[model samples]
Target chain A: MRPLTETETQTLFAKLANYTGTSLKNLIAPLDNGPNADRYVFRIQQSRCYYFTKTGKFRLHITALPILAEHARYKVWVKANGEMPFLYGGHIVKAHVGRWSDDCPEHQGVVVYSMNDTPLGFGVTARSTQEARRLDPTGITCFRQADCGEYLRDEDSLFATS
Target chain B: MAPTRTTTIKSKHATNKSGIQNSKTSSKARSNGSSGDGVSKKSAKSKRTTSKGVALGSVTGKGAALNKLRKKRRVYTERELGIPTLNMITPVGVEKPRGGKKGKVFVDDRESMLTILSLVHAEKDGQIESKMMKARQMEEIREARKAEAEKRVEERKSKLDETKEGLKKKRKRASAARELEGEGGRREEEVKGTKALKLKKTVSFA
Candidate 1:
């Protein structure tokens, strides 16, 4: 790899800022002159973005941070009973929703978490918070976009050499 | 501006005279001295002529004198001549940060951030929509498959029930036929023989 172009950087930063907000600055900051200083660079590989140090000794996936869930503006917590279903690639139904960030708009990106504050995945809201409140138990609250369970279920495709 | 323009014309005329003198001196040096010595002599002569031009300009008028002094000062101060001051060489040091606090590493402008975010969203909108559509199609196919499987299971259950009912009916008919034969003739012969045998045994013992 090569360094990201201006447009690519802007797009990446914009997507990341949705979850990390101003905290993204810390990730992009230049390294100070010191023995332990590491210059982090962003690169794209196989259509996926990677953030890694200049020495290639350490790397970070764009979505590797659990901190994103913690800082996300739009969030949804599934109840204990619903966590397994969500991990198994099921959408969040109104009955399974324990809580959600207030004023969440429909079709917005949302971080999915367990009731115990463990981040499971990320998804898009199917309805606004107000609309969700009026939905039936079986109505979908958020569509399942991706979850940690894919690490196991999709291990073959994820780790394929090709 | 007028004085500067006149000074410029005077400087051009002075340069023309100096060029002619340089040609004459260069020819004389070539005949009188070696190449290296001639170069040094030519440079010294040109310097003298430039000094003479400044002196002449100063003698012309007060404005011309100021102009000559200003030009001389600029030549000494600005290493890169003709370029605007704004385009001058940057000092050797850490560059000051832009569009943020003095020492901040990242730009924190909310308006720019919002615009970038909107641009990203617009670019991804079509992609997300296509993905969602595919997912919806997959869900529909899954639901159809599930319904078909359930229907097949129900059909199998109904066939199993019908077969079970047929077997029960066959068992009932066979049992009824056995009971009818026992009541009519098959059981009467065995009961009559038992009575006859008991009476004969009692007679012989008496």
Candidate 2:
């Protein structure tokens, strides 16, 4: 039940900024000395951060909203055959990649999606789009970091009551 | 009518033959439908015959007359009466109403938005405050440790100086004591030599 330190805040913000971009500022506005001060608070428990009202009700634990994916700059669309494999924690290969954000840089964070625009997960590009075009079909394109399918596969650890 | 009855009888015979074929082909079709194309074609032929048999039965049955009578009587409603129905005409630029279906727009209620903003503000402020406090504590600890180290270094330097000064004083005292011992030893030797000369002269006179 402690507050997040400076480094932890910076790391969290940096990761969130990748998805939310400038919209993150709207979500986390600076506190004002005016009448509407001290209404909410952030607390950490067992390494899980929570944002809640000062009255200890109406908490939001899943702070990273999915809308962030919509505004993300770097994106990779996986083919139908690759969707299941990506959800299963496999990296995106060239054969399974349907499309990608134009001029995406290598090693940058990217949001992964299905061909129909359903966001599947977040990953880091293994190669730039130009480099990926020259790669073999089996070559790795993006390395998956997390996926929405973890809700089912990692249910026990993700939703720990403790 | 006689021809139609003969066709019905022929279809009945075909259905019997199809029943036997169905039993024989069911197992083979179950294994692989692709390999049972001939069986499927036979089944399609049987289905066509069954449909014809149904048509013939309808033609001969009493229900056929009832179906004809029902088709002739036209039940007219508002459209036939030339009356306008309840379907409203949408205005030129107005979008059609989407009934019962969920819309894509995510509406954040005022209360919920306030709650979220407050939480964000609290988290940011608390994090910043905690970070500053931690940094202040670390700086204090660092200063304390540095001061203690410097104090220890000064103490060691003074102790080394005191030890060096004591060694120098001890060396000076040892040198001075050696010089005095040498002076006293030389005087005692000279007196002993003079005494020995006087004793020798007195012994010769006697």
Candidate 3:
């Protein structure tokens, strides 16, 4: 676990900011590459952000949900339509998508939230914002990349940072 | 290219179907163990006896023939111990033969029963042990045969190598002999040429 250089840290931070559609400074004001450079840990105050290895992007952790909840630019809200359990289980359809950010394009990562604005999980847009806007009720709008329940079941903090 | 989302759902469904199959097989094995009869017989019976339709005389209601069809089949335990009521009904100083499933009967004599059970147990153990011994003997024979074959192959290879080596030496000697003969012929030719030169000199002098 080698410590990343300043240049490497800046590059990673830039990539993270672009992928997550968040300001670099706002996400991690004082970026700490931790002891190991191979793994990067960014914190907004104390809550750790979850990075989905499959997507190669930082996900808004269940802990960081409160902070990202107000930032509607990166959130997509879906109406359960009496299928709230299914939505929580990480199944989302076009009919379930009540509202979403207009800027989210096809393949862009976004935070999935309930109609009540409770963060559900992280999802990737299968259809473009334009296509999703015109999507049929039965069409699939997005696919869940990571569910909040996954990390919650582990019962361990992401990292121990005093 | 962006990955499709439907593949995950399809894979999950496949896993679920496989899981159900595994559970069904386990339950089938458990049923067979408890029933004493193999599942093949049970399945065969079910396949052969399909109800065509309810008969007109069959009673309808709680006592309906269909209710019996819906009822679960009872699995009987092993018929080792004799019936208790039959023993009580039997006259004093005389024991009746124990009746068992499908026309099979066992003697009520305790000594004969113990001897039969012991013989059956010994035969089963002997069969299993004999099978294991046969397998071990066959494995040993196979290994011995393999080793012998490998030894024969090595012997043949060595024999062939010796013959090939001898042939190579013979070829080398034959080539050396031919080279010596060629050298002798060339020397003889040179000697004849020198004699001819001497003869020419003598004729010129004369």
| TM-score ranking from best candidate downward | 1, 2, 3
Summarize candidate 3's per-residue lDDT along A1-162 as a digit string, tens digits.
233333333334433332343232343232445553242233233223333344344344455544444442456777767245434455577877778776455665567777887777666677766657667887777777656675655446555443
| Sort by DockQ, top down from the best | 1, 2, 3
Kindly report which residue stretches of model 2 are placed more than 4 angstroms away from their true locations once superposed.
A30-42, A50-67, B1-206
Q: lDDT per residue, candidate 2, B1-206, as tens digits?
A: 89999997777666544444455454454556445667777887788766755675566667656655644647776557543334325443575566866633332233444454445545654554565466556657978999999999999999999999999999999999999998887778777885543324343554
Candidates 1 and 2, the one with greater TM-score: 1
lDDT of 2 at B18: 48
- Fnat values, one per model, are 0.05, 0.00, 0.00
Please give, for residues B58-128, the per-residue lDDT of candidate 3 as tens digits: 55565556656655566654344343343455554575456644542334333333344344445544543
- Model 3, B116: alpha-carbon shift in Å? 88
Give every prediction's interface RMSD. 8.9, 14.1, 38.7
The candidate 3 chain B region of ten consecutive residues with least summed lDDT is B104-113
TM-score for every candidate vs. truth?
A: 0.41, 0.37, 0.31
Chain A, model 1: TM = 0.79
> lDDT score, residue B12, model 1?
62
